[model samples]
Target: MNSDAPRPSPRAIASLLVLSCIVGLNTVDRNMLGLLLPQIQQEIHISDMMLGVLMGPAFMIVYSVCSLPIAWLADRTSRRGIIVCGLTFWSLVTAATGFAQNLVQLLAARIGLGMGEASNMAPASALIGDTFGGRYRVLAMAVFAAGGPVAIMICYPIIGRITAEQGWRAAYAFMGLAGLGVATLTLLIVRESRVDPAHGKAGTPVATQAASGIWRATRQVAGTPGFALLCLASVMVSVNFGAMLAWLPSFMVRLRGLDTATTGALLGTYKGLVGVAGSIAGGLIVTGLMRFDQRWLAWAPMLFCLGIIPAELMLLFADAPSWWHIGLAADTLLMSAITPCLFALLLSLLDSGLRATGVALYLLIFNLVGQSIGPLAVGMINDQLSAAWGTAALRSSLLIAPLSAAAGAALLLALAARLDTSQAAPG
Candidate 1:
């Protein structure tokens, strides 16, 4: 692949769009649990710690554990098939979640959901890299990344309202059924891009070379000091994000005195829109800055992380609803900006054949520290503080998120300082 490859064609763009939509649906199903957490807690009579288990460890453990094997398959097989099968399976499992009558059943369904989602990021990202070469690849990925916020924007109001009227179970079933449509479309429309010779060679009769190549690729990525710093930063940022996703809505409902509908609407419109803008802006800014100095990729996210800390602090302490909303919007904008830049930087750290496996490893570490532990830690903290803080326990528990962002900023700055600008990866 050429670094100066031509812009993606209409067919490529269409495929990207469909794949992005699938990504969006995947996010919507995953995040809907957060939106409906309060209701589910009320109905199931589970404690905060139990809710954290369902939202965090139960889902992330399976999601993280399965990612590598799935990514390995994706690297050697049809990426499209992996995505379609995962999508279809997860969607159906999400519907099964709606039928759960107890916490154990819900946990089981969530575990299945995690297994299904395990097939997504590595393959989807690999596909994007193959479809959109050169500088446009970053922008295309930013578009794909926008799917999460977009899903929130579209699903929040609809799911929130449905949960208010029809119940949380209905929201799950509806989202699950809707995903089946996306799965069908993906199966029909998304074709696999031509595999690189390095990847094709993995399928050769000699298994030793394939294993050796994978080992060498892993060693190469692991040996990169800058990539190590990036992963540290990613873990910190993911901690903040995971904690927020698990508890923010509940915080609003409890501390800010907003109902679920109002909370969803505000977040959907304000946070979602601002986040989408930030993602696009960050991609453009980082890519443009890379034209002058590649270090800007790490620096941009560092600055964003530093900026987000104050916004998050304000959100935690704000007394007025207007002030709280303002803080949330600002925090979300800065936080969202960091993702595209971080992902682009990660892609630049390794060879093309290792991209999917590299991403899976990144996600594995990210999910283990961030998704599996972050929310659970917060929940445990909230429970511990409840006696002293009462209704304010959740608010106080969230203070750790900003501290994580601060650590992330420091890590990013370290990464920027160490980044070798002249050793840019090939497209």
Candidate 2:
């Protein structure tokens, strides 16, 4: 830790809390589309493949494309300002989704939502890195990663009940409007940190390196064998995780004959409670293990990825709802453990100056390849198999998730071999 870096203050803690809420809001806005997919499909009269497109590529393409530039701006300027603008923009666009009458309108709204959310992760990750120091850093990141599961927990039941009574549009409107308040709070409370004078000098090697532009930074990061493998592992894990998240509610409703409300309550509780527990536990366990052997960073996620394959398989093939819930909970628990560990590893590989760009590049790959293709692939598979398998098509289509998890486990194991754990600390 830099001796000159200020100790954590109340304002810094409040800023992290605000940032976590922003992350949670982003997750709710993005995942709510998937939660409301069945309703949206009925109203728009779209095919499963089109629903997949709407869920995946519609938002992700814009998000992936815009994230790099927005992240670049954050690396150079005010991250707080970027977040305020993004929060406001996405909130309005999310609310506008309620007014969409057709596929084109919905798609446009989603594109705007994606553009807005593109400002989130990279800048937020950089801010968190700047805010917290060693030892506390991983735990802080775990808390940050908890935002998604926490959002899912809160949104699922509320949105589910609202969709049941009012409509999916109303749910979208309600959540969207609520986000503006968070944005307002963030604007009022969060303050940007001043860069160290030494860090600002162009003559400094770190500054010169980070100033080389996005592609150059990307290439330099990719040049590392371990980091490249970690990215590949991330893509595989995200494909499995993203596909399951997008399709799980519909699968439960259609295949298990559960009501939307039931599906929401069940998943919400599981992700909220179990998921948060797993993230924190995983962060603590990995942080403890890092003191002995930093190789546990990759090994922990590898083990979790392997655990996901069997749990997901059981979830997909099971006949009983209880069995399904159990499988889902187990899967969520294991998968939740991966986020903090993987992010900690990624941050550990980069310097503070390039962390935002590195995170942006990683997110670009994750969204572009994983988020963009995963759901689409599942939907395509479901459509193709429907003629023969009927309702079972969805179940069979989900087999891809477990297979992707297996690949992720393999990739992580490979990544562990290449990483030099002793030198894994941030440059």
Candidate 3:
């Protein structure tokens, strides 16, 4: 089978596993800070805004900024080497996070970690796109993307325990060591496939080619209607994602009266098992739906919107029943389910060479607009409302949940119509 064609083969599975590990490791490592934030706050005397910024903008700026260049390199260079190097860099930095003496130092370490983390996604996404084409690619994406949940399940508990007993520093050190091991394995096992001819001959300097390629890929995707809508949907999705991931555990503990251990465990459970199931389900659904009609891209966000209804209710009024446990658990499961479908649609819209840069552009906009603002915005709202509503303020601020979901669904619908209109237009 040609590299560009759709096929099911051993190469596809191998590529899927590698991308899965990349996604899984990045998600787990990034979230480790969330689990340890309270400890870091106590030790560092930082404000909530500062904490939010560190998790949001401070890391994201570097992560988002570097992604395009790294992705550009991935398109023209050895993706395996890029991924392995990225894994090693971030893992080492994650471990180095143990050594911070002040807020500035910790923030700096996170920036380095962000840069390293940025390297993995674009390249890995592109690799999977190349390995598995057409309908099968969606399932491969689902499987690979399922790594995020899998890592959450496996890593959260370990980080929680380490932070609880050994101190946050120990947790950092341990995460770093684990990352190092994974990095070594990646270097040894991930084989590089032949580069596409359009990427130019392999021996050409990657840096020179990457500069031209980045501009070209950006032009292609920017001009493509499907890509633009996906990017828009990504921003809305990030707003929902950033706010929840950053604040949800705190919300659960404060509102439901759960201890950190319980909150962490619950989060792990919902995000781990339910998230994995949702990703796989979304992939399968999209794969099946695309077989009959490609317009499911427009229909996809509606499912996301529907999921938000239960989620918002759980976040807001669900406190009344004293069944906050069930509400929180259910909310988490629903929250985790919608994203894989969104991503599957976006990935399918582009070809292999352009996918990474497209993903990078998506992440760049996603982090700058949504990830950068969403958490801080919610936190500020919580602060203002907290004085009046006290703990209940979190419930109010979480209104973003349903609202963002609805908006996203609308955007997706518009996008589908645009896509159809574009296809009908004469060349």
Candidate 4:
């Protein structure tokens, strides 16, 4: 390698990692609530529905509504500054969550936390998309995306441990402090990417560029076949992803009789390490295969989804004891590995100009509907059936995940079939 050819600046790498940690920490905070739910509920006198509201509507709705505006700001202002301020705000809120004396206080804090978190991804994504070009962009995005899993690995277990020893409140306080530190680092390290001079501000203001309203950007994206299909596929992916994130640890404890710490470790290992490997591998593989054929966008998801079926079945019926652990592990790996390809496929659909909005929309549907609804629905099902089947009900609820996954596979396959094989990027 030509070291003299101006390698990616150390500052850039530091910024990216800090951005990654910021993302990781955010997810960690989110997942900590789930991991410590039993304790939090018992202490705070909340119901499962309240848990749903805290993790779901309180957090996601605000986050989803705000993301576009924040991304719009990123388009119009400094991506670095937006991300730094966003991180600081959320970090403080995450800490404040610990001090909540009742549901109202916690709900308000989570909402504030949601608002802060909303700013992190869109601009950070736009920044990474701008900083690295083409194939490396996919890889860099994959590395940054790994923040989800890596944060899960570190944060889940840490929360589990803290909840065991210092209590959930202490865990929340610790996470908040961690977020503050990361936000400070982001302020110092992350530099804004150079914007195209022709555009009035950060690049082109997404709203002004579209003659129509903000909905216009979404409508334009929806009109594009590949982009539309990718977004649809993303929602399906999110359903299963959400189920795993919010409930699997709980499921393991209730169904398999694992302790909270063990459940966290299991999820962190399979979902974090294995899933992250899959994400990075998916991005790199698609980039390499695209050198030969662009159809890899469709092909990767088709193949990855196909690979998950058996594992999904294993998870659905793992109570028989013979295949429980094996099935659980495989499902974990399958879900993790599939994500990188899913993201790369979505990115491939948009022109460079629309990537931020495109990514934001992808996230909007994926998070708002899939992440927000999937877990709550599953939880509702478990709660409803817990009286009839005891703890076995949670396992039954997970069946929805794989069934949705299969439907997602069908959607991606149909989309891939329609893709033009012509060797050209969209102009």
List residue ranges in candidate 1 displaced over 4 A: 1-3, 194-217
lDDT string for model 3 (1-427, tens) is 1224435566557666766877888987876666676677778887667777887888888999999899878876788889989999999898888999998898899799889999988888777665555556667777887899888887777777777788889988987888888877776666655334433345654433434657877887677557777777767877877877887777776777766666667778878888888778776776666655676645765666667766667656764745555655555555555666666566656555567787788888878777877777787787788789988898788777667767777777777776652241111
What tens-digit string does per-residue lDDT give for candidate 4 at 302-341? 7777667778778667668668667766776667666666
Backbone N/Cα/C clashes per model: 0, 0, 0, 1
Which residue pairs show collisions in model 3?
Answer: none
Ranking the candidates on TM-score from highest down gives: 2, 1, 3, 4
By lDDT, the best candidate is: 2
Q: Candidate 2 at 191: error in angstroms? A: 2.6
The global Cα lDDT (0 to 1) of model 3 is: 0.73
**Cα error of candidate 4 at position 219, Å:** 3.8
Relative to the unseen true structure, what is the C-alpha lDDT of residue 107 in candidate 2, on a scale of 0 to 100?
87
Q: Give model 2's TM-score versus the native structure.
A: 0.95
TM-score of each: 0.94, 0.95, 0.90, 0.89
Model 2 steric clash pairs:
none
* Residue-level lDDT for 293 in candidate 4: 69
Which residue pairs clash within candidate 4? Answer: 275-336
Q: Model-by-model lDDT, in order?
A: 0.82, 0.84, 0.73, 0.73
Candidate 1 lDDT score at position 239: 92
Per-residue alpha-carbon lDDT of model 1 for 25-47, expressed as tens digits?
A: 87788877888888888888888
